[model samples]
Target: MSTITTIGFDADDTLWQNEQFFRQTEKHFATLLAEHAGGHDIEARLLEAERRNLAHYGFGIKGFTLSMIETALELSGGKVPPNVIREILDVGREMLSHPVETLPHVRETLEELAGAYRLVLITKGDLFDQERKLAQSGLGELFDAVEIVSDKTAATYQRIFTCHGDGPGRSMMVGNSLKSDVVPAIQAGGWGVYVPHDLTWVLEHADEPTAAPRFRRLEHLGELSALIERLGREG
Candidate 1:
């Protein structure tokens, strides 16, 4: 069965817990707001601002910070005290400059799997931020190809697999989300494996598939290499 030659992976929550960091930052923001703002107005404003800004600016610390600033300006009605706005900006900047803390088993598993497989990383986010995380996590060196996509759909998966090769069923996709990672790959005629994430954003959570049965869920990345090896052997 040795059909698979390339294995695709989704970054962020799949490789590491991305949503946890943001959630931590959000907590800090809420704390800052409660201290400076009248009540929880800062928190509320930030939420509303995020909802509004998801369009103009996608994900990443930069967009998040910009939204925080926008929220501050609006909440203050242009009368925002300098200290309050500065505090928000400072927090946002800190998040941007923060180091990447990858989830457990990420580095070790990649080290083991990269040797036998053609690894590819497929992530969706602000190009710069995604690249920064990749570089920082030290996982970038393992992948033969790195793709920072704006979106992942069934069509997108087809294009990727076709470009890689059509004959070898050796290609597999591993990720955290059911919607973007599993369904798309399965629909594209490939294996779709899910590694459940402890923390992920609302947007990252995807709707269940309506058609083909292309979903395999795993608790951790450590279990993936064996599955891939078995598939490789079977093929």
Candidate 2:
């Protein structure tokens, strides 16, 4: 039998279309600020603001919107018109209300694994926004527990796994981010399954843990069930 008794999933690009919306909004934001700054400069400054404000705002559309506003103000020397800020707020509102689009194979994979193991949805973001996405995704019923956290770290995974399953040693965390989803879970002694998403946020990028014995990478979630079975057989 597989040593893994619990499976944790990341919500944002892992289960549904998320970053793409942010990307689209970013383009619109750039267009809105074209008179004030170049696209490349705006993008770089926005990323810097995001990195700097993470501790204060955490993560989600609200934080992202704040970062965009801050970026606009800085790039435009605090002279960006009020209408531009309004447009930015509208963009953020649109993102918050955007329909949740589940990625291919997500539903089927969750359905196949739900009965056999403890499944947890572990994602860090604005609680209201995360909850909204979860409710809209319609995948909430399949998970044994849901965690909307401020961040993902080794201690976070250890605590979650211990609360919801056998523990980190018997758990697996699967997601698109090698930084937030895979690395910390591995550090907590669980299997870290990296599922690459094409539109991953630049901030979430991390070097792959190719040397780790428990590290695994998948093209997509469709391959997850077979990989779990294979791991079980190996054990």
What C-alpha lDDT do the candidate models reach, one value each?
0.76, 0.95
Residue-level lDDT tens digits of model 2 in 51-115: 99999999999999999999999988999899999999999999999999999999999999998
Q: Pick the candidate with the highest lDDT.
A: 2
Worst 10 residues of 2 by lDDT: 1-10
Residue 119's lDDT within candidate 2 is 98
What tens digits encode model 1's per-residue C-alpha lDDT throughout 1-235?
Answer: 4466778889888776677777887777666555457546776777778878877887677788888778767766777678877887887777666788887788888888776777888888788778888888888889888877767887777777667545225478888888788887887778888888877666567765545544567789889878776765765
Clashes found in each candidate (C-alpha, N, C closer than 3 A): 8, 0
